[model samples]
Target: MQKKPFTELGLSPELLKAVAKMGFEEASPIQSETIPQLLTGADVVGLSQTGSGKTAAFAIPAIERVDGNLRAPQVLILCPTRELAMQVAEEVAKLAFFKRGVRELPIYGGQSYDRQLRGLRDGAQIIIGTPGRVMDHLERKTLRLDQVGMIILDEADRMLDMGFRDDIETILGQAPAERQTVFFSATMPPAINQLVKKYTKEPVNVRIQAQEMTVPAIDQSYYEVDRRSKLEVLCRLIDLQDIKYGIIFCATKMMVDELSDHLKARGYSSDKLHGDISQSMRERVVAKFRKRGFEFLVATDVAARGLDVDDIEVVFNYDLPQDAEDYVHRIGRTGRAGRSGRAVTFVAGREIWKMQQIIRFTKGKVRRERVPSAEEVEQKRTSEFLENLRETLEKGEYKRQDTVIDQLLDQGYSATDIASALIHLLGGDKPAAQPIVEEQPRREYPNYQSREYPKYESRKSSPRETEARAPREHRESREPREAAARKEFHAPAERREKPSRSPRREPSAASHEEGMVRLVFNVGNAHQIEPGDFVGVIAGVTRLPKEVVGRIEILDRESLVDVSDECADQVLKKLNGIKFKGRRLNVNIAR
Candidate 1:
């Protein structure tokens, strides 16, 4: 059977152009089947797992039907979290980017109401938002649905799980009865089925087969490490594997923030995505990750919802998800678009039962792998170096540096000694050993386990007291404020701060007494500079052997390259005077 194209599915030319620019050559299984029926004005009920390209399945059709000239909202998309709302809005914006006068707005909690109000007044044709914030806007009369032509309930199962049924029903009731409705969910519970029956009118059912729920392309594995040692194990795995992009999923927002910060401190390119961050910051983080500015992203389950990145090479379950279904979603971030990927989970003691449940749900085998030790990392590095050397030898490109190798051999050094020395000079230290951690015993939940539904409570603020407080009350509370103000206003000499470790020090073209001179450059891997580029540019410009390069430390914005201290002046003169990759190399000394 031949597959249909987005243009053939009755999408507008502007939307087709947008999809092509996004590099989507063909539609996913769901999109191919759902878009045609959706364009025919029939309601849709789509059931597919996460990472199944479901967002575009409905969004493309919705944007095509949007009346761009209409200032009022014509389409409403209800998501479960602020992160998902923003993600959906981003996708919609891309589809509508070429459409003139079309605007899409995303509304969610933790965002300034004034900003959302301003957007509403500015005329948004489509509104994608969370249920709580949507209800808030409806109550304030900022979002009117009288002109709404279509409504999409995304992640319907999660909305029910989060107890948003009342809010969803209220919002749906506000829209016109004749509008088209679309319902999408990962699972069809009795409640979800009931809601579908009451809301959708003779919806066209499009379901991906059960076999498609589990992604076979992903190599799923887990390591039974203690909770305390998980971070160490993660760092070791990252160092061992050549990962391009990955996501570390945690159960809570607090854990995501902590893990992101810890990885950043450990010299990893990482960012945090969660519910607590502002909408603008979340967008910026996603943009950075998409642009390859950051290689790793740490996020909670709610924050990662609606994420649709296709190049994630791996998914790390930093903490096991609370619900078994979330295990599917976390791993689904990878192995997308027919590409093979990997998913590694760190399972601690007593959580083995949860792991078992996940394995059972996916009906997939997760092999247990032993953590790599320090000696293993060293062995991997040695193997990589030997491979690179063999490639260079096979290419027959070392004739220019033959004299340098002969001189080193003449200096009472054997081939093994020279290679070992080179390895040692290239930051080839063994990985540090991980600390041992003991798992705590699990305790059973109380009798409330059977009645585990969420409960709601309302708390109102207390009224002010009629009588005035004593002077001590004012004095104690205001003292800290006054002290902070005084500290801010202190004189520069009185408030001397510690000097930064990365002080600016220019490179000197002078000879050194040592065998090699060490020079640092304000460029590193964080600046998208690779090790080979650093060595190649220096060797090509100086007519020196690449093997003579010593330890190179690539920091956030600077790189330190070690050359023979004797030839440091010559190397500096050659490099500092030339340009590499269109940027002048700032050769300097280590601070």
Candidate 2:
């Protein structure tokens, strides 16, 4: 089972060219298994973690199936968050770059409605949006789904977790029933199953089981500093090191552009690579970088994915990656083909904890390094300059230029003075006198040094003091109370005739014994529902504390959940007809 290229996925030549330009040579495991099925108009369920190339897997097929001449949106992609919606839309747009009349619009919240209206009115063939915003447009009649031929639920589990199940169902129900549905989720809970069962028909399940990534042999280290001083430190390091070709990874597109511009302003050959740049520009920048046209390439994680260059000497983490796995990929850009490379990550004071998590994730392979001081940089530069001069002298190249020195000597310049001036000129300015900003280590607030609040101090009580503190009204005569207790005890022993100990009470689903009931809902493991989903929904709708919701048992086709007797009626009333991860809840007391 060999993997194929995007060209073998039955995509149009236009799309194949776009994919190739995007630097994808071989299909990812998910893409290899899914693209073929999706191209054949089959439903698909892609179970993979984030960054597993699932976006291209579905986007390519959807784009390939699009009828460019149609003005209405033929494909709808639902994401959990606005960020994801925008990212997906970017990918879709990139894949549809060469496809004429294949306009795509990202419909999400926090944007101008008038803008979305204009885009929709102007005719976009593809719509990528969050469930809520998409539902809003649907309700307002601004977005029509009658022509939607394909529906994709990206990060479906996250959408459900965000309580978008009802909205997703409403949107899906409105779409053409003959439409192809594709779902991608990191985990398949029972609720997700119910959604699939109700929506898709015989979907091809492509599960790329999670595997531990093997980190490359790059020397990974980080230095903590304040956010404001990162640029200065970066410049200092760039000035000190002999970086042939390197990448400075940023978290956002703006940061990438800003860092790139800053480096360029400092007279270093650098360029930015990010999603916002056009396809041609991206290709040009990548081409230049591969040819060593620039010393530094500042790029975001998404933009740098398809970057294939082997001679990258260093990778600087200008911003810590939000995803732990991205850290591996960023550093992996270097240290390829038996070449040992260095990955230097710049961490802000607050990001130290995140850096530690990355270290632990990499099994402590990521070490910490002290930030180089101005003196250190100067010393290293001088030593390197002297070494290069000595090497040049050993090569006897100075003999060919001895005449120039002799000419200078004839001009009344002493040989020693000429040699000193050359060394001084070649050594460059003794790194600026500016003091290097010290590393900003993670520091706790002074007040948090002692968490023991004085108000919560414990008090020790003596026996006499405790007895004296008893209320006089409730106190009884000691002698009389003892005599009455003995009489009652003796009478009980005679009457009981060695009565057995009280029966132990078994724990039930409901925390309370009296007026407690177990309820059955029409959802279970067969529906791919998990207890957490039920708990989240019930607690969310009923305003009941999660702790009060009793044990949940998910069976084949139904679930038995316990609720407090007081809120049982309210829970059923609120949850009835309410969908949890796309399935309506038909909750009733157990028989």
Best by lDDT: 2
Model 1 TM: 0.49
- For model 2, residues 309-330, the per-residue Cα lDDT tens digits are 9888899998776445777888
- Cα deviation in Å at residue 508, candidate 2? 83
Error of 1 at 270 (Å): 27
Q: Local error of candidate 2 at 320, Å?
A: 12
What stretches of model 1 exceed 4 Å from their correct place? 1-7, 189-198, 212-361, 367-379, 383-591
User: Model 1, residue 442: what's the lDDT?
Assistant: 25
Whole-model lDDT, model 2: 0.70
> Against the hidden reference, what TM-scores do the models get?
0.49, 0.52
Q: Model 1 over residues 347-441: C-alpha lDDT tens digits? A: 76535655765676678779999888857765675687789889988998765666877999899889899878776656423223334444432
Displacement of residue 452 (Cα, Å) in model 2 is 44
lDDT of each: 0.69, 0.70
